[model samples]
Target: MLAPLLSDPDTVRAADEIHRGLHALGVRDPHVQAAIAELPLEDAAAARALGRRLTRTGTSTLTVNVGIALLARLGEPEDVPYLKVLGLLRALTRPVVGALTALDCPTAALVWLADHAEIRALRHLIDAIAARDDHEARTWLINAPLDSGAVGPSTARRVAEAVQLSDILGAEQTDTQAVAQAVAQAGRLLSRMTGLRDYRPEILSYRQATTTYTAFVARAGQLPPTPDHYAILLSVALDLHSGPSVLLDWQPGQREALLHALEAVLHNESWTAVAESEPEDPAERRRVHWLRRTARQPFHRATVSRFRVEATVRDPADPDTVEARVLIDGRPLVPEAFGKGPANSPEYLLDSGRLRAAAEPREVQLAEAYCTEGCCGALYVTICREGDQVVWRDWRRPPSRQPRAELPEYRFDAGDYDAEIERAENDRTWAWPARNTARLIAAGLREQPGLLTRWDGQVGWIGTDFHDQDSTAISFTYWPGLAAGQRDKDGPWLQFVWSLPDDGTPPEHQAATALRQLAERDPKTYAQVRGGSRSHAEVLGFPWPEPEDPEVTT
Candidate 1:
């Protein structure tokens, strides 16, 4: 494709003019790559000059892409500097990264460019770093795996594999700083590897995760309690409690030993003091509060039952929603196990009628259709507390749904089930503004269900909507209509919108106001709402009325 351009003695050789010529000639990437691959030595030198010139001076992305592709095939190490410069343009990251990798770029230059590269286009850079036996690259990966924000938990495994994390952890010559950094990185890595995020690999992906965690616990005891160390330890501790089944990948005693070690360090008086003080960093503060809110519980297996259950907050942005997954004998009981769709939202599972054991066997909805629940039906398993055991049996789907074969029943240690539920419930690290409002309102209703008696409704689902730039509208969905206290098979739904200021007003205070408003207001006076309509609290004359002036008679 470039034969005519390379041979023309009178052709304008300026980078822009050449770029324009290439565009005019309708040259494509494959044509350019093919022509560069077959070019003669003298012609290759001229092409390299053209590639270098265009890469350095061209403003158009198409021209720069062609320049970088040429360099990737025929350029030398001397071109790494300019390639690194061009890597800054996120638009040109992929082509520039490829070019830099092909030129045998210095490890430092590669690392610098990788820092600026997007995670989606970072595999080549990571592989380039991994290919070299460079200590610098290994150290960088250990200390600051997530620092650049170039890679998230989803892509961190690539970084872990690139550094040969398992080899480093098992090596006899690994130094203290490297081990410590590895421990910290591994904690963050494992914490995310749990089934919380879709497409993220589980902790089993890393063979040495168990060792790194144990090492982290040991290192924590040796160092003075700090926000960073405490945060890492606390996060990993929560993950151990509620993440995927550890015994599936860990040795028999390893899970207990690591959990015990973590408990010791996390609950140490000195560490507790630091955590209680509430560190300034937002992330650390969230991590530390989990321990602050819950009592210290022992990490031990109560019964020999093989059932393990965990509530996963798959969507942190929607914190009020969660899903429950079970592992029997270290094997997942997922939707795919029975040809179902996905798991149902377990947000209301803790309401004494779902996963929480009850005196009578309760048929709980476990998994549901990927589409609407009514259309494709849901999966149900009967759960009940039988003495020291939490038994799950009679696995079936919605009436007439497939899977005619009866699935096996499971009996979990009641102690283990309760502990896991508590851990998952207390995990407020995923909390946000909307969830906070919902949580407070839910707590208030739980404390006083009769508060909505005047309205003749029960809270169904609580959510929030953007009211304005500085405030939000807390919405509550109630069942069986309002006022008349009527009931039917399906029942009707009503919504109340409470607009609250974002001026740091306590959520509990908002909850209190909402409760009081619900108790005092006559739902009959409010306009009937249908579809997506909502009754605004301010319009209903109940928005935290201002204090009245006290009389001097007092």
Candidate 2:
């Protein structure tokens, strides 16, 4: 694209005209996008004019894309915030989100795209950015609350891997506040997502790009839409969020306290939700009613949900230079991160409870995923081999007590719980046959990637996020066809579960042993299951591999 532009004046001018036409019509210029990627540089007499344009002329989103290209070329921290703003500009529409990915600033562009819920890919990119870094970029991602696209883990890992390498190579400085703001925005969005009820593929749409569902009814088929059940189960999450009172009514006071809080949300009338809603703008200026919580609970406060994505040069410059994963509410699931591809997946992972993030390239290595800066912020997850059973430990927690069951909600929305708390709410526990897997795969345009490659495809299989039994926690789900033969006795299965607690773990070294036990039981499971964020999979099962709470106390 650049060679043509630079070599031929006609090409350059013609390209300029194309940009003009795209601006006129509401579409981004893919040609302009490619040109910026290929060449971006202009030095004035002054070392820093604060602005040397990527191209002298373009629309707002185009301008932002050009600016992002310029920054990637210059690799300056000063440009991060600006790029962030530009990203916000383009995020308002679909055309921009699709065009921004080819540039080196996929992370920047993705942050902008996922800010709104109107488009499905927005959540896929959110998983990529949030899972990739612990900085402010992740903050933006968390605030977006993806569209229940199980691509969380796959996309998160891809972005995380890229960020880690860039940091190791000193590509970018740590800009905490900027990224934190992003995370906060993403989290707030998730709280309100309960309104955009999950779509039931009970009917696939031959054409579905309009706001008026009524008008499309004629064109759209009722034969289970392309992405029929791809919507986040917020309207259906009651299955996991709800539990019998006795499940939490333990002798200890903490057990009772945790149970009561969850019940409040599971049964609260205000928490009542309508899965689908009319499309409306939810920008920073727009009064996103859900964000304006009447009251805040620990489920919303003490906890923070983010994706810790990481991609590496195990080789870059490859078709998919990125790998990612999504962390739901707060948990990370390596299986989905490495198995599913997120860039295009319709549904994103929301059920993962924890993940291990890597910042460097190696034949094989494991790293603990970091929680946000808030309350000593959960555990820095670590897993290791221990006999036939895998085991885990919180490098940051006390060696004495380690949590294993799913974690408890940090804050409960006092908005509408009771009215929504029906038996279905309590029964939604992790997508059956693997809710995360089914929902994430269901969102894609083609046969799920996992189905095509588990072991033979170019990238093999990338995993996405899947919830175990907890809305705030996640458990690893298997990639279709990704199989591992045993060392003799009984080889590990193609897919397996590490029943950690979404139950209720404290801030300290709570579930260390449980995680470690998981690693030991099936050391290869993580490798076979986890890693990568912009990845999705194809599987066949329902509520398969039910995870048990790996806690000894309970």
* Model 1: worst 10 consecutive residues (lDDT sum): 545-554
lDDT of 2: 0.30
Which segments of candidate 1 are over 4 A away from where they belong?
A: 1-47, 115-128, 147-149, 166-179, 198-200, 214-218, 245-247, 280-284, 294-436, 440-508, 511-554
Give a tens-digit lDDT track for model 1, residues 221-293: 6555766666566656655654443434667777777778788777778887875786675545544554454
Clashes of each: 0, 178
Cα miss at 457, model 2 (Å)?
43
Best by TM-score: 1
Cα displacement (Å) at residue 229, model 1 = 1.2
Candidate 1 structure lDDT: 0.59
